[model samples]
Target: MHIHFIAIGGAVMHNLAISLAEQGHQVSGSDDQIVEPSKARLKKANLLPEQVGWFPEKITEDIDAVILGMHADINNPELVEAQRLGIRIYSFPEFIHEFCVNKTRVVIAGTYGKTTIMSMVMHVLKTLDRAFDYVIGAQLEGFDSLVKLTATSKIILIEGDEYYASPVDHRSKFHLFDPNISLISGVEWNDSRTNISKEDYVNLFETFIETIVPKGTLIYNKESTILREIVEQTFDCKINRHGYKMPEYSINKGVTYLHDGDYRIPLQVFGKFNLSNIAGAYTLCEWLGVKRDDFYKAIASFKSSIRYLEFVASVNGSVVYQDFLFSPYKLRTSIHAVKEQFPCQGLVTIMELNPYDVINENFLPQYASSMDESDHAVVLVNKESIKDKNIVLDDLEQDIKRVFKHKDFVFLTDLDALEGYLESFKSLGFNLLFMVSPKHNTMNIVSFADKFFKNF
Candidate 1:
C-alpha cells in the first residue's frame, strides 16, 4: 500500500508514518514546518520530505490513501490536492478504524484520567504477552511509539480523545472508534475552541454510549458523581455497565500500595485519584480475561512518567514534583495528594494558568479553593497566553482569589520572576510541587527547575 501524510511532523503523525513504512507500506509525507524528534525520526525512517510544505504535484492518482493531521486545516494544499484526485483520505482516527475494522476496539474515554488508564491497560496487557494494537496521547515509559498496529492482533486499545478528529471532521475522535469494550474514566464539563457548551460536552458521552458495539462492556468511574449519574441515566441493558471506584489502599513512607487482601502491593504511582484509575484499568483487564494475580504483578512494574507526580529532585528534606494537571479537579486531587504523601514537609505548589479554560476569564472561577491544600501557592499566568483570549490579569486574579481564598497565595506574570520566587524558597525547606501543564512554550521547565534544585 502507498500512503501519503499531510502535516507529518506532528509527534504522533511521524510515528504513524514510520509505523506504516516499517509495516512494508510505501510511505511519503509533507509538512509546513518540522521540529526535532519528529524531524529526526522521520529522517531515520527515510520518510522525510525532501522539501517542507505541501505540493499539489505530489498528490498523483496512484496514492492509496492520504492521512490528514490535526495541524492541517480544511483548505490545506495537500488535502485539497488529494480530494482533487478523488483519493481516499483518512483522519487520524479514521485510519485507525480502517486498520482495525475486524478487531475488538477498546477505547478509554473521559475528560480526565484517560491517558493514565489507557497506559495501565496497555502495560498490563503487554506484560501478559497479549498481542494487541494501541494508540495513546502521551509518550509512556515502556511504549516505543504512541501507536502500534499488527495484522494478527485482535485487540486495539486507544486513548479516546473528545477533541476534534481533524480540521474537516468536527466529530469527537472517540465517536470515530465505535469500541466493543469501552471505559469512561470520568466526565467533566469542559470548554473547547468550538465554544461547546456544558450540555454539548455531556451529550458527547451520551452519544458515545449509544455507539458501543452490541453487548459491549463499559467500565466507568463510580467515584465521579457527574460521570456516574450520566451512566445511570442512560441505563442500557443491551450494554454491560460496571462502575469502579478507588481501590482500598494505604500509604507508607510516601509510597502508595494497593491492598489485595493479605498482600499490600507497592506501586510506582501515588494518590487516591491514581488508585481510582487503577480500579478502572483493573475492571477492563478483568473483562479481557487477565488473571487477578497476573494483573497485580503487571501493575507493580507500572511507573508513571513526567507530569504525573514525577519526582524531579530532593534538595535536603524538601523535594520537587511535577505533573501535567489541566483540569480543576485534577489539580485539586494532585495538590491534596502531595500534601498527604509528604505530611511532614511544608508543601508549596506552583501552577500555570495557561490552559484554554484558564485563559478564559469566564471559566477561571471553577478553580476556586482548589489549591487551598498547599501551604504556599503560586499561580503563574503568562500575559501572552491570555492576550489572544482577551483575558486580563486583574480579572484573572480576582477569579483566582475567589476560588483559592488563601492567605499565602500569590500570583506572578513573569517567568523569570516566578523562577526567582521559587529560588527564594530554597532556604524555607519545603516540598515544591509544580502543578503545571507542559504547554508553556517559552520556558523549558526541567532546565529551569534543575537550576533551583542544584542551587539548593
Candidate 2:
C-alpha cells in the first residue's frame, strides 16, 4: 500500500510515516519545512521528501491513502489534488485508528498529566516484557519514536487529546480512538482555539467518554470534580468506571517512596501529580492483567518522558529542573510537586506562558491561584508574542498578581530582564524550576540555564 503524508515533518506525523514504512508500505510525505530529528529520521528511512514543498504531481491516484497532519491546511495543493483524484484522505488519528482497529486500544486523556501517566504505563509494559503498539505524545526513555505500530501487538497505548484530529476533521483526536479501555486524568480547558468556553471543553470530554466501546473500562482521576460529575451521568454503553487518586507515599530526602502493605518502593519520579499519575497507571495496568507487585517493580524505575521534570543541573545546594508545563493545571501541579518533593529548599519557579492560548488576557485569570505554592514565581512571556496575540500585559499582570496571591509575582517580557532576574537568584540557593511548553520559544530557557549553571 502507498501512503502519502501532506505534512509529514510533524513530530507525531513523521514517526507515523516511519512506522508505516517499517510495516513494508511504500510511504512518501511532504512538508513546507522539514526540520531536525524528523528530517534526519525520515532521511534515514529514505521516506523524507526529496524536496521540501508539496507537489500536486505526487498526489496521483496510485496513492492508496493520504494522511493529513494538523499542520496542513484544508486547501493544501497535494490535498486539493488528492481530492480531485478521488483519493481517500485520513487524518493522523484516522490513520492511527485504521492500524489499531483490531487491537485493544487503551487511551489516556486529560488536560494535564496524560503524558506522564501514559509514560508510566508504557514503562511498566516494556519492563514486564510485553509486546504492544503505542503512540504517546512524548519520547519515552527506551522508545525511539513517539509512535510505534506492529501488526502482531494485540494491545495499543495512546495518549488521547481533546484537540482536533486534523484541520479537516474538527472532532477531538480522542474521539477517534474508540478505546476498549480509557483513562481520563482530568478535564481543564487548555486550548481556546478548540473550545472557546468551559462548557464546550467539558462537553468534549463528556462526548469522548460516550465513544468508548461496549463494556469498556474507564480509569479516571477521582479528585477532579468536573470529570467525576461528567462520568456519573448516563452513557448509552455499559461501561466500568474506576477512579484513582494519589497513592500512599512519602518524600524522604528528595526521593519519593510508594508504600505497599509493608514494603516501600522508592520511585525516581517525584510530586503529588506524578503520584496520582502512578495510581492511574497502576489501575490501567492492573486491568490489563499485570500483577500488582510486578507492575510496581517495573514502575519504580520510570523516569517519565523527556522534558518533564528533567533534572538539568545541580549547583551549590541548588538544583534546576525542566518540565513541559504550560497550562494553569500543569503549572500549579508542577509547582506543588517540586515544593513537596524538596520541602527544605525554597522553590523559585520560572514559568513561560509559552503556549499562545495562555497568553490571552481572558485566559490569564485561570492561573490566579495556580502559582501560590511557589516562594518566588516569574510569569515569563515574549514581548513580541504579547503584541502578536494582542494581549495587554499590564492588565494580565494585574490578574496574575491577584490570582497568585503574591504582590511580588514578577512578569518578565524581555529576555535580558528575565536573564538578569534569574542571575540574581544564583546567590539565593533556591531550587530553580522551569515550566515550559512546545510551540513556544524555549531557547531562552536553555540559554539561561546553561549560563547560570555554568557559572557555578
Best of the candidates, TM-score: 1
All models: lDDT? 0.83, 0.84
Candidate 1 clashing pairs, residues 3+ apart or interchain: 307-323, 307-324, 368-403, 369-403, 369-404
Off by over 4 Å in 1: 191-194, 355-359, 383-403, 426-429, 441-443, 448-456
Write model 1 residue lDDT over 148-174, tens digit each, in one string: 888889999988988889998899999
* TM-score on alpha carbons, each prediction: 0.91, 0.89
What's the lDDT for residue 142 in model 2? 82
Worst 10 residues of 1 by lDDT: 436-445
Please provide, for model 2 over 1-456, each residue's C-alpha lDDT reduced to its tens digit, 9 standing for 90 to 100: 999999999999999999989889999888999999888999999988888998999998799999999888988999999999999999888888888899999999998789888888888999999999999887777888899999899999999998889888899999998999999998765555344788888888888999898899999999988898888774555898888888898888888999878879999888777788899999999999999899989988888666778888776777788887656777887888888888888887887775465555577677777877888888777776667666677876676677678645888877888878766665345788888775676446667776665544
In angstroms, give how far residue 310 of model 2 lies from its true place.
2.7
What are the clashing pairs of model 2? 368-403
